[model samples]
Target chain A: MINVENLTKTFGAKRAVDGISFSVERGEVLGFLGPNGAGKSTTMRMITGFLPPSGGRISVGGHDVVDQPIAVKRLIGYLPENAPAYTDMTVNGFLSFSAEIRGLRGDAKKKAVSRAVEMCFLERVLHQSVETLSKGYRHRTCFAQSILHDPDVLILDEPTDGLDPNQKHEVRQLIRRMGEKKAIIFSTHILEEVDAVCSRAIIIDRGRIVANGTPLELRRKSEYAGAITLSVRGVSASAVTQKLSQLSSAKRTSVIAENGSKVTVTVFPKPNMDGELTRAVIDATQVWQVEELRTEEGRMDEVFRSITMPDTAKSPESRVQSPQS
Target chain B: MNSWANIKTIAKRELVAYFASPLAYVFIVIFLLLCGFFTFSVKPNLFDRGQASLSGTFFFWHPWFYMFLVPAVGMRLWAEERRVGTLELLLTMPITAWQAIVGKFLASWLFLGLALALTFPVVWTVNYLGTPDNGVIFASYIGSWLMAGAYLAISCMTSAMTRTQVVSFIISVVVCLFLILAGFQPVVDFISGFAGPKVVDFVTSFSVVTHFEGFQKGVLDSRDVLFFLSVIAFSLFTTGVILRSHRAG
Candidate 1:
C-alpha cells in the first residue's frame, strides 16, 4: 500500500534522509530502528507528505505523494514525532475535529470518535482539556486523532515514545492488530518493540539503511548466534577448548571462565551451519560431568549495538566506552 | 462545496480556540472600551460634534485601533501551531494549504468583526441622538471589517514567518503601522512637502486609510474595495509561500 524509492531529503547542506528505498504492503508492520537523529522522523514526514523529499518518488495507495498529496494523505493517518495536539481543546473536541477534517461527519463522525476514544483509552479524559492530561494521555489523544478515519495506511513516528510500559504494550498490540489490514510503518528506539511487534525491521544510521530483514533474520546476524555454551566440572579450560576444537562443525572455541576444577567455555560454529555444532559440543562435553549447557539465541540488544556502533563493540578499548562493561 | 467544508472545519476550530480562552473576551471588552473612550471622551466628542453620524467620531478610529488589535488576534494563528508542533499535523491533513490559510484567516477576521459589531451601542446612541446617515455607517462597518481583514492577513503572513508569537505580533504591528502611516494625514503631508502630487498619490494609494476614508462617506468605490481585497489576497498568497518554504526546508 506504500512504496518509496530512493527517497532523499536535504536540509540546506546536510542530507537528512539519503537514498531510502522500501515498500510496505497490507498486513505488514515495518519497525524503523535507529539511534537518535537517524532521519527516522524525516523519512516518515516525507512518506506522509508533510515534508517533500528532495529526490525519488513516494506513492501511497497508488497516489504519488508529491503529485497527489491530498489523495495520498487521505489514505494515510500519520502521528508525528512528539504527538502534538491542540492543547486548548478537550480530548473529545480534538477527536471530533479530527474526524470532521477527515471528512467524517454526523453519525459517522460520532462513531469514529467514540471508537477511537475507546481504542485509545481516552474515555476518562474525554471532557478534559489536552493541556491537563499526563504525557501518556496526551500521546494517546494525538494517536486517536490519527486513527479516526481508519485510513488504509498509518505512519507513526515513535508511537510508543513517552508511554508507560503497560501503555506501550497496549499500543504495540494495537499496532500489531491494525497492521493485519493496513500497511503500518512505525519508528521506535526500543529494541524489544522491534522484536515484539515487527514482522520486519529496518535499521537506519546517519540517513542510510544498514540492515533490513525480518526480526529473526536480523537477530541471527549477532556474533553469538547459534553458539554453544558449556559449563562442566572436573575439567581444565584448555582441555575443554581442545576437546571442542576437535569437532568438525566448531569453527573456534574460547574459554569463558575457570575456577577450581570447573571450566566454562563456548564453541563458535562455522558459518551457514546449524544444530550439528550443538550435537558435537554435547558429545565432546559428555566426557566430563556436565553442569550446564545451552545454545544461545542471538540477542537483539547485541545486534542493535553492533550494527549501530560497530567501531567500539569488539576492541580491547571498547570496555572503556561501553556502558555494559 | 467540498473544499468549503474543509475551510469551515478549520474556521470552526479556530473560533473555538479563540473563545476557549480568556483572550477573546478580554480583547472584545478592550476593543469596545477603546472605541467608546476615543469616540465619546476625546475632543470632537460625539455629543459636541452635534452629528448623528458615527462616521467621524466612531468609524474614524477603526483603522488606527485595528493596527494593534487585529495583529494581536492574528499573531497566534500560525505561530502557535508552529510552536506547539501542530503545524505538521495541520499541513499533513487532506486539505490543501490554501484552505487552512483561508479558514484561519476568516476565523480571526470574523472574530475582529464580532468585536467591531459589539460597538452597535454607538450606533444606537447616534440613532437616538438625531437622524444619521445609516447607509454611511453600514458602509463604514463593512470597510472596517475589510480593513481588519487586510491587517489580519498581514499578521498571518508574519506569523507564518516565525514560531514565536511575540515576534509575529511585533513584525505585524510594524507592517500595519507602515500601511496606516502612508495615508496618515501628517505622514502624507510630510511626504507631499518634498515629493510633489504624483509621488504623494502613489504613496497614499497603498495606504488602507486612504481607501477606507471613502467607505466612511458611503462611497462604494470598486477601486477601494479592490484595494483591500488585493491586499488580503497578496498577503495570504505570501503566507502560503512562507509556509511552503518553511516546510520545504
Candidate 2:
C-alpha cells in the first residue's frame, strides 16, 4: 500500500532522514525503532505527505505523494507525535469535526464517530471537554480521530508514548488487529512493542537504517544467540570455563555466575557449529552434574544497544546490520 | 461540491472553536461597548451633533476599531494550530491548502460580520432619531465588513509566520497600520502638495481608507469594491504561499 524510494529530508545544513527506502504491504505492521533525534518522526511525516521530501519519491496506494498529495492523504490515517487535538472542544465534537473533514456526514459521521469512540474507549468522556480530560483520554481522543475514516494506511508516530501499561497494551493490540487489513507503520522507543505488534522491525540510528528484520531475526544478531547456557553444581567456575573452551565446537566460554559450589557458564558456539555445540557439551559434562541446560534465545535490547550504541561497543561485529538475516 | 463541503466543514469547525472559548464573547462585548462609548460619549457625540446619517457617527469608527480588533480575532487561526501541533494534522488532511485557507478566512470573516451585525441596535437608534437615509447606512455596513475582511486576511498571513499569537497580533497590527497610513487623509493631503495628482492617487489606491470612503458616502463604486476584494484575494494568496513554504521546509 505504500512505497518509498531513497526518501531523504534535509533541514538546511542537517540531514534529518538520509536515503531511507522501505515498502509496506497490507497485513504488515512495520515497527520503526530509533533513539531520540533519529528521524523516526521525520520519516513518518514524509510518508504521510506532511513534509515534502528533499529528494526521492513516495507513493501511497498508487498515487505520488508530492504530485497527488490529496489522493495520498485521503488514503492515510495519521496520529502525530503528540496526539494533538482541539483542546477547547468536547471529545464528541472533536471526533465529529474530524469525521466531517474526512467527508463523513450525518448518519455516516455518527456511525464512524461512535465506532471509533467504542474502539478507543472514549464513551465515558464523550461530552467532556478535552482540556478537562487526563492525558490518556486526550491521547485516545486523537487516536479515535485517525481511525474514524477507516483509512487503508495508518501512519502513527509514537502512538503509545504517554499511555499507561494497560493503555499501551490496548493500543498495541488494536494496531496488531488493524494491521491484518491495513498497512500499519508506527514508531516507538519501546522494543517490546516491536515484538508484540510488528511483523517486521527496522532499527535506524542517526537517520540510517541499521537493521531490518523480524523480531526473531533481529534478535539473532545478538552475541548470545545460539549459545548454550549450563548451570551445574560440583563444578568450579574456572573448571567449567576451562573445560568448555577446550571443546572443538565451542569458541570460548564465560562463567555467568559463581555461587559457592554451583557455577553457571555459557559457551559460545563456533561459526556454523551451533548444532554440534549442544551434543559436544552434553558429552563433555557427562561426569559433572548438569542441573539446567538451555540455548539462549537472545535478547532484543542487546541487539538494539549493540547496533545503536556504537561508542561503548566492545565487539566490532555487532555494529553491522544484516537486514537479510 | 465536494470541495465546498470540505471548506464548509473546516469553516464550521473554526466558527465553533471561536464560540467554545470566552474570547468571542469578550471581543463582541468590548467591540460593542467601544462603538457605543465613542459614538455617544466621546467627542462629536452622535446625539449632540443631531446628525441623521451614521456615516460620521457609527461607520466612521469601524476602520479604526477593526485595525486592532480584527487581528485579535484572527491571530489564533493558524498560530493556535501550530502551537497545539495540529498544523501537521490539518495540512496532512485530504483538503488543499487553498481550501483550508479560504475556509478559515471565511469563518473569521463571518465572525467579524456577526460582531458588526450585533451593532444593528445603533441602526435602530439612527432610524428612531429622525428620517435617516437607510440606503447609505446599509452600504456603510457592507463597507465596514469588507474593510474588516481585508484586515482579517492580513492577520491570517501574519499568523502563518509564527506559532506565537502575540507575535502574530503585533505584526498584523503593524501591517494593517501601514494600509491605513498610506492613504490617511493628512498623508494624502501632504502628498498632494508635493506630488502630482496621479502620484497621490497611486499612493491612496493601496489604503482601505480611500476605498472605504466611497461606501461611507453611499456610493458603491465598483473600483472601491474591487480594491477591498483585491486586498482580500492578495492577502489570502500570500497566506497560501506562506503555508506551503512551511511544509516545504
Candidate 3:
C-alpha cells in the first residue's frame, strides 16, 4: 500500500534520511527500528506528506505523495511523533473534528468517532479536556484521532512511547490487531516490540537501513551461535580444554574462570558445527558434573550495536569487502 | 461535497473553541466597552455635532480600533496549532489548504461580526435622540465588517509566520499600523512632496482608512468595495503561500 523509492530528506546542512527505499504491502506490519536521530521520524513525516522529501518519490495506495497529496493523505492516517493535540478540546470533540475533516458527517461522523473511541479505549475520558489527561491517555487520544477516518495506511511514530507496561501491552495488542487489515509502518527503538508486533523488521542506523529480515532470520545470522558457555565441576581445567579441543567440531576452548572445583569454559565452534560442538563438549566432559552447557542466543541489543557500530579493528577495505547479507 | 464537509468541520471546531474559552466573551466585552467609551467620553458632545451621524464619533475610530482588536482575535488562528503541534494533524487531513484557510477565516470573521453587532445599543441611542442617517449607519456597519475581514486576513498571515502568540500579535499590529497610516493626512503630505501626487494617491488608495471613509459618508463606491475585497483576497492568498512553504519545508 506504500512505496518509497530512494527517499532522502535533508534539513538544511544535515541529511536526516538518506537514500532509503522500502515498500509495505497491505495487511503487513513493518517495524522501523532505529536509535535517536536515526531519521525514522523524518521518513515517517515524508511518507505522510507532512514534510516534503528533498529527493526521491513516495506513493500511498498508488497516489504520488507530492503530486497527489490530498489523495495520498486521504488514504493514510498519521500519528506524529509527539502526539501533538489541541489541549483545549475535549476527547470526543477532537475525534469528531478529525472525523469531519476526513469527510464524515452527521450519523457517519458520530459512528466514526464512537468507533475510534472504543478502539483506543478512550470512552472513559471522552468528555475530559485532553490537556488534563495523563500522558498515556493523551497518547491514546492521538491514536484515536489518527484512525478515526479509517484510512488504509497508518504511519505511527513512537505510538507506545510513554505508556506504562499495561498500557503498552494494550496498545501493542491493538496495533497487532490493526495490522491484520491495514498497512502499518511504526518507528520505535524498542526491539522486543518488533518481535511482539511486527511481521518484518527494518533496522536503520545513521540514516541508513543496515539490516532487514524476520526476527528468527536475524537470530540465525547473528554471531551468538558460534559461542557457548559451560559451567563444570570435578574436571581439571587443562584436561577439559584439551578434551574439548580434541573434538573435530571444536574450533577452540579456554577456561574463562575457575573458582574452587568449578570451571567456566568459553567454547568456539568450527564452521558448520555449532550443535555438533556443543554435543561433543557434553560428551567429552562426562567425567565432570555439567552445571550449565548451552549456546548463547544473542540479545537484540548486541545485534543493534554490532550493526550500528562497525568494529574499528577491521580495516575499512576489509569491512567494505564483507557482504552484509 | 467533501470540501464542504471539511470546511464545515473546521469552522465548527474553530467557533466552538472560541466560545469554550473566555476569548470570545473577553473580545466582545472589551470591544463594546472601548467603542462605547470612545463614542461618549473621548469625542466632543454628540449633540453639538448635530449631524446625528456616527461618522464623527463611532465610525471614525473603527480603523484604529480594529487594527489592534482583529490581531488579538486572529493571532491564534494558526500559531496555536504550531505551538501545540496540531498543524501536522490538520494538514494530514484530506482537506485542501484553501479549505482550512477559508474555513478558519469565516469562523473568526463571524465572531468579529457578532462582536460588532453587540454595539447596536449605540445605534439605538442615536436613533432615539435625533434624525440619524439610516443609510450612513447601514454603510458604517458594512464598512466595519469589511475592515474587520481585511484586518483578519493580515493577522492570519502574520500568525502563520510564527508559533508564538505574542510575536504574531506584535507583527500583525505593526503591519496593520502601516496599512492604516499609509493614507492619513500627515503621511500623505510627507509622501506627496517626495514622490509625485499620483504615487501618493495610489498609496493612499490602498490604505484601510482611505476606502473605509467613503462608507462613513454613506457612499458605497464600487472602487471602495473592490479595494477591501482585493485586500482581503491578497492577504489570504499570501497566507496560503506561507503555509504551503511551511508544509514543504
Candidate 4:
C-alpha cells in the first residue's frame, strides 16, 4: 500500500536520509528501528508528504506523493513526532476539525469523530481543552486524530514515546489490531516493541538502512542464536567448565554467573550444530544437579547493536541477562 | 471549488482559535479604549470641531491605529503555528499551502473587521449630534476595512517567514512605517530634494494613506480599491512562495 524508492533528503551539506528504498504491503506492520538522529522521523515525514525529498519518489495507496499529494494525503493517517496538536481547542473540537479537513462532513464527520474518540478512550476528556490534558492523554488525542478518517495507510513516528507502560501496551495492541487490515509504518527506539507488533522490521542508522527483515530473521543473526544456558547448583564451577570444554562442536563456553556452589554457564554452538550443543548440555545436566536449562533464541537489542554499531565499539557485556531480556 | 471548502474549514478553525485565547479579548479591549481616547480625548475632538462629518475624528485615527493593532492581530497567524509545531500537522493535511495562507489571512482580517465594527457607537454619536453625510461615513468604513486587509496581508506574510511572533510584529511594523511615511508631506519633501516631484508623486500614490483619502471625501474610486486588493494579492502570493520554499528546504 506504500512504496518509497531511492528516497534522499539533503539539508545543505548534510544528507539526512540517503538513498533508501522500502515498500510496505497491505496488512503489514513495518517497525522502523533506530537510535537518536537515525533519520527515522525524517523518512516517515517524506512518506507522509510532510517534507519533500531531494530525490526519489513516494506513493501511498498507488498515488504519487509529490504529483498527487492531496490524493496521497487523503489516504494517509500520520502521527507526527511529539504528537503536536492545537492546545487551545477542546478534544472533541480538535478531532472534528481534523475530520473536516480530511473531507468528512455532516453525519460522516460526526460518526468519524465519535468513533475516534471511542477508540482512543477520549470520551471523558472530549469536552476538556487539550492544553489541560496530561501527557499520555495528549498523545492519545493526537493518535486518535490520525485514525479519524480511517485512512488506508498509517505512518506514525514514535506512537508511544511518552505513554506509561500500560498505555504503551494498549497502543501496541491497537496498532496490532489496525495492522490486520491497513498498511502501518511506525518508528521506535524500543526494540521489544518490534518483536511484539511488527511483522517486518527495518533498522536504520546514520541515514541508511542497515538491517531489514522479520523479527525472527534479525534475531537469528545474533551470535547467541541457538545458544544454551545452564545454571546448576551443587556443581563446582571449574568442574562444569572442564567437562564442557571436552565436548566437541561447542564453539565457546563462557561463565555468565558464579555464586558460591552455584554457577551459570552459556554454551555457544558452532554454526548448524545446535543439536550437538543441546545434546552435550543435556548429558552434562545428567551428571550434575541442574537448576535451570534454557535455550537462548537471541536478543533483539544485541542484534540491533551489532548491526548498527562499528566493530571497535561493540559492547557484548551490555546485553541484558534477565528472562525477557 | 474544493479549495474554497478547505479555505473555509481552516478559516473557521483559526477564528475559533482566536476567540479561545485571552489575547483576543485583551486586543479588543485595548483597541476600543485607544479608539475612544484618540477620538474623544485627543486634540481635534469630534465635539470640539462642531462638524457634521466623522472624517476628522473617526477615520483620521484608523491609519495610525491599524499600523500597530493590525500587526498585533496578525503576527500569530503563522508564527504561532510554527512555534508550537502545529504547522507541520497543518501543512501535511490534504490542504495546499495557498489555502492555508489565504484562510489564515481572511480569518485575521475578519477579526479585525469585527473589532472595527464594535466602534459603531462613534457613528451613532455622530448621527445623533447632526445630520451627517452617511455616504462619506459608509465609504470611509469600507476604505478602513480594505486598508486593514492590506496591513493584515503583509503581517501574515511576515509571520510565515519566522517562528517568533515578536519578530513578526517588529518586521511588520517597520514595513508598515515605510508605507505610511511615503505619503506624509515632510518625508515626501525630503525625498523630492534628492529625487524629483514625479518620484514623490509615485511614492504618494503607493502610500495607503493617500488612497484612503479618496474614501474620506466620499469618492469610491476603483483605483483605490484596486490598489488595496493588489497589495493583498501580492502579499498572499509571496506568502505562498515562502511556504513552498519551506517545504522544499
Candidate 5:
C-alpha cells in the first residue's frame, strides 16, 4: 500500500535520507530500525506529505505524495515522534477536531471518537485537558487521533517512546492488532520491539539501509548460531574443553566460569549441528553433572552492532571466534 | 460542497473554542468599555465645537479600537496552531488553504462584530440625549464592521508569519498604525512639503482613515466599499499564499 522509490531528503549539504527505497504491502507491519539521525522521521514526513522529498517519488495507495498529496494524506494516518498535541484542548475535543478534519461528522464522527477513545483506553480522561495528562496518556491521545479516521495506512514514528513498560506492552499489543489490517511502518530504535511486533525489519544506519529481512532470517544470514552454556560439576574446565575440542561439531569452546566443584562452559556449535556433539560431550565427561544446557538466542541488538560496526575495527579475539561460520 | 463542509467544520470548531475560553467575553467587555469611555469623555471634549454625531464619536476611534482588538483576536489564528503543533494536523487535512483561511477569518470577524455590537448602548444613549442622525449611525456601524474585517485580515496575515502571539500582535498593531497614519492631516502636511500636494492627496486617498471617514459621514460610496473589501481580500489571499508555501516547504 506504500511505495517509496529512491526517496532522498537533504538538509543543506547533509543527506538525511539518502536514496532509500522500500515498499510495504497491505496489512504488513514493517519496523524501521535506526539509530539517532538515521533519517527515519524524515522518510516518514516525506511519505505523509509533511515534508517534500529532495529527490525521487513516494506513492501511497497509488497516489503520489507530491502530486496527489490530498489523496495520499487521506489514505495515511501519521503519529509523529513527539506526539505533539494541543495542550489547551480536552482529550475528546482534540479527537473530535481531528475527526472533523478527516470528514467524519455527526453520528459517524461521534462513533469514531468514542471508538478511538476506547481503543487508546482514554475513556476516563476524555474530559480532562491534554496538558494535564501524563506522558503515557498524551502519547495515547495522539495515537487515538491518528486512528480515529481509520485510514488505510498508518505511519507511526516511535509510537511508544515515553510510555511506561506496561503501557508499552499494551500499545505493542494494540499495534500488533492494528497491523493485522493496515499497512504499518513504525520507526523505532528499540530492537526487541521489532522482534515482538514486526513481521519484517529494515535496519538503517547513517542515512542508509544496512539490512532488511525477517528477524530469524537476519540471524541466519548473520552466521551466528545458538551457543550452549553448560555448568558441569566434578570436572576441570581444561579437561572439559579438551574433550569438547575433539568433537567435530564443536566450533569453539571456552570456560566461562569456575567454582569449587562447578564449571561453566560455553560451546559454539557449527550452524547445522546434529545431536552428535551433545552426545559426545555427555558421553566423554564421566561424573560430570550437566546443570545447564541451553542455546544462546541471538538478539537484534547483537545483529545491529555486528552489521553497523566496521569490520576492520573488530577485536582480534572476536575475529578468531568467527561466529558466522 | 467540499468548501462548504470545510468552512463549516473550521468555523464550528473555532467558534466553540472562542466561547469555551474567557477570551470572547473579555474582548467584548473591554471593547464596550473603551468605546464608551472614548465616546462620553474623549470625543465630547475634542469635538465640543461640532455637533456630536455617531460619525464623530464611533467612527473616529474605530481604526484605533480595531488596532488592538483585531490583533487580540487574530494573533492566535495561526500562531496557536504552530505553538501547539496542530498546524501539522490542520495542513494534512484534505481541505484547501482558501477554506481554512476563509473559515478562520469569518469566525474571528463575527466574534469581533459581536463585540462591536455590544456597544449599542452608547449608540442608544446618544440617540436618547439628542436627535442623532440614524442614517449616520447605520453608516458608522457598517464602516466599523468593514474596518474590523480589514484589520482582522491583516492580523491573520501577520499571525501566519510567526509562532509567537506577542510578536504577531505587536507586528499587526504596527502595520495597522502605519496604515492609519498614512492618511492623517499632519503626516499628509509633512509629506506634501516634500512631495507635491497632488502626490500627498493620492497617497492619503489610499489610507483606511480616509475611506472610513467617508462612510462615517453617511455616504456608502462603491469606491470606499471596494477599497475595504479589497484590503480584506488581499490580506486573506496573502495569508493563504504564505500558509500554503509554508506547508509545502
Candidate 6:
C-alpha cells in the first residue's frame, strides 16, 4: 500500500509536480498517464524516495518517506526511466548485486535472482554482459532487477518503453500477474497499455491530475460515447443529416462526407439514449437505401487528448505556451 | 552490523567493476612503471645513492604519484555513478549516504593498497643489497597507504560535488596539490610573512606532506596517524554531505 498526500516538487521557477495526492492499494495496478514533462517521472522518484519532495508527505507500507527513507525504500521495487543499469555487468551479476543490496544472502539471494530471471524471461542472456544485449533484453534485465526482492510496492517508469509488441505483451502479462499481490504504479505515454494492464488510471498534465477513472469510465467521457455514424446511399447529404436531426433521441446531427448519391452522417444522441437512437436510425433508413450503419464505443484516444490538452483543444496555438509559462 | 553487509555489497561491486574495465590494468601498469622508473632510472637513483634506505628514493615518489593516480580512481567513484544515472539506483537502496560514501572510498583505498603492495620487489631488492631497516620500510608502506586514503577521500568528495569525471579529476588534483604543498618550506615561509607562527603551524598541520614526513623517518607517531585519519574522516564526511545534498537536488 502507498499513500501520497499533497506531494509537490519544484525546481527553481518550475513546478515539476504541483500539489497532488493519490493512493495505490495492494493488488491494484494504477496506470500513470501523462505527456512528456508532465511530472510522471518526478512523482515516481518522490514515491521511491530517490528525490525529496518540496512539500507534503509520502508513506510506503506505513513508513514516512522523509523520516524513514531507508525503510520506505526497503518496501519499494523501483525501475527508473530508461531502465538505467550498469552496462558492464552481466545479467546474473547485476541481479545478484541488486539482491545483495536488498538484504538477501546465500541461497535466498540465488533463488531470488533465478526467480526474477525466469519471470522477466531473462534466462537466456543471464550470463551475457548487459551492454551486449539488445535494448529489449536490457530493459527486461532491469525489470528483473526491480522485482528481484519482490518488494510490496513496485513503481516502474515506462516499464515497456522500448520493447517489441510481443515483449510488451509479455511484460504486461507479467505486471498483471504481479498485480495480484503488489501495489504497482507505472507511468507511460502509451494509452493502450492502460487498458491492457491497469485496473485504474490516472491522467496527469502540467503538474496536475487531470483525470482519474477506469478505462471504460474514461471512454464514456468522450463526446463520441453515444454517437453513431450512418452511411446512406440514394440520399442527399443534407437530406440524411436532416432526417437524423429530426429523431427524438438525436441531440445533434452533422454530415460527415458525401460521395455522389451516398452520404455519411454522424448522429449524436441525447444522454442515455443511444439505444433509442440506434433503433430510430434503423427505422428511418428502412425507406432509404442504407449502405452501412455503425455505433461507436467511444474514442479513448480522443478523450485522453482532450483531457490532457484542453487548452490546446479550444485555442490550439494560443495555449501552446500555457503549461510552461 | 548489517550495515557492514550493505557496505560490503557496494564495495565488492565497485571493486569488481574497477577490475572489469581496462582502466584498472592501465592504472596499475602506469603506477608500477612510474614507481620503478623513479626508483631505478631517475636522479637520486636507488643504486647511485649507495644507501640502504628507500625513504629518499621510494617513499619520496608516493605523494607525487598519488597526486594523480588517486584522483583517477576517486574521479569515477561518484561522478561516473551520477553521470550514468546509477546514483539514483544506488542511493535509493536501503543503504544510507554514509555507507555508500565509505564503501566507495574503501574500495578505491583497497585498490590503491594493492598497487602499493606490488612494489614489494623494491623491498626485497633493498634487503638483498644491504642491511636495510625493515621497520622503516614497514612504517613507510603504512604511511603511504594512509596518505593514499587521505588523497582518495579528498578526491571522492570532489567527485561527489560534480557529475563530470574530468572536472572531478582536475579539481581533485588542484585540491590535493594544495594539501601537499601547504607545509613546504617555501610556502610556509611565504605564509609566515603575513601570519603569526601559530597560524603558520596550523597551516602546516593541514599539509599531507608534513604529516607523512614522520612515517618516512621510521617513526610510527600517533600524531601523524591521527592527522592522516582525521583528514580522511573530514573529507569522507564532506563527501557524505555532498551526496546527501545532491540527492536532495
The per-model lDDT (C-alpha) reads 0.91, 0.90, 0.86, 0.90, 0.83, 0.89
Tens digit per residue, CA lDDT, model 4, B118-196: 9899889889989999999999999999999999999988998999999999999998888888998799889999998
Write candidate 6's Cα lDDT for A270-317 as tens digits. Answer: 888989999998998899988888998877777888888775453232
Tens digit per residue, CA lDDT, model 1, B90-184: 99999999999999999998888899889999999889989998999999999999999999999999999999999999999999999999999
Candidate 3 per-residue lDDT over residues A81-148, each given as its tens digit: 98988888999888878887777879998999999899888989999999899999999999998888
Per-residue CA lDDT of model 5 for B1-249, tens digit only, reads: 877888888887888889878888898888888877787678463246356477766568889888888899999999988887777767666766688889999999888888888877877766776878889888878988998999999999999999999999999999899889989889988898889878987888778999998888899999999998999999999997888666544
Q: Give candidate 6 misplaced runs (Cα > 4 Å).
A: A271-276, A314-325
Q: Which candidate tops lDDT? A: 1
Per-residue lDDT, model 6, residue B87, is: 87
Candidate 4 per-residue lDDT, tens place, A182-271, comes to 999999989999999999999999899999999999988887889888899998777776777667767667778889889998877788
Query: Model 5: clashing residue pairs?
Result: none
Instruction: Assess each model's interface with DockQ, reporting 2 decimals per model.
Output: 0.91, 0.83, 0.77, 0.83, 0.48, 0.78
User: Which pairs of residues have clashing backbones in candidate 3?
Assistant: none
Poorest lDDT segment (10 consecutive residues) of candidate 4 chain B? B240-249
Q: Higher lDDT: candidate 4 or 6?
A: 4
lDDT for model 5 comes to 0.83
Candidate 2 lDDT over B43-124, as tens digits, reads 7889878888887777778888988999999999999999999888888889998899999999999999999999989989
Indicate the worst ten consecutive residues by lDDT in candidate 2 chain A.
Answer: A316-325
lDDT string for model 5 (A19-43, tens) is 8989999878999987788889888
TM of each candidate vs. truth: 0.96, 0.96, 0.93, 0.96, 0.89, 0.95
The i-RMS of every model, in angstroms, reads: 0.6, 0.9, 1.2, 0.9, 2.2, 1.2
lDDT string, candidate 1, A79-196, tens digits: 9999999999999999999899999999999999999999999999999999999999999999999999998999999999999999999999999999999999999989999988
Which candidate comes out best when scored by DockQ?
Answer: 1
Candidate 5, residue A313: the lDDT equals 37
Candidate 1 runs further than 4 Å off: A245-248, A251-262, A315-325
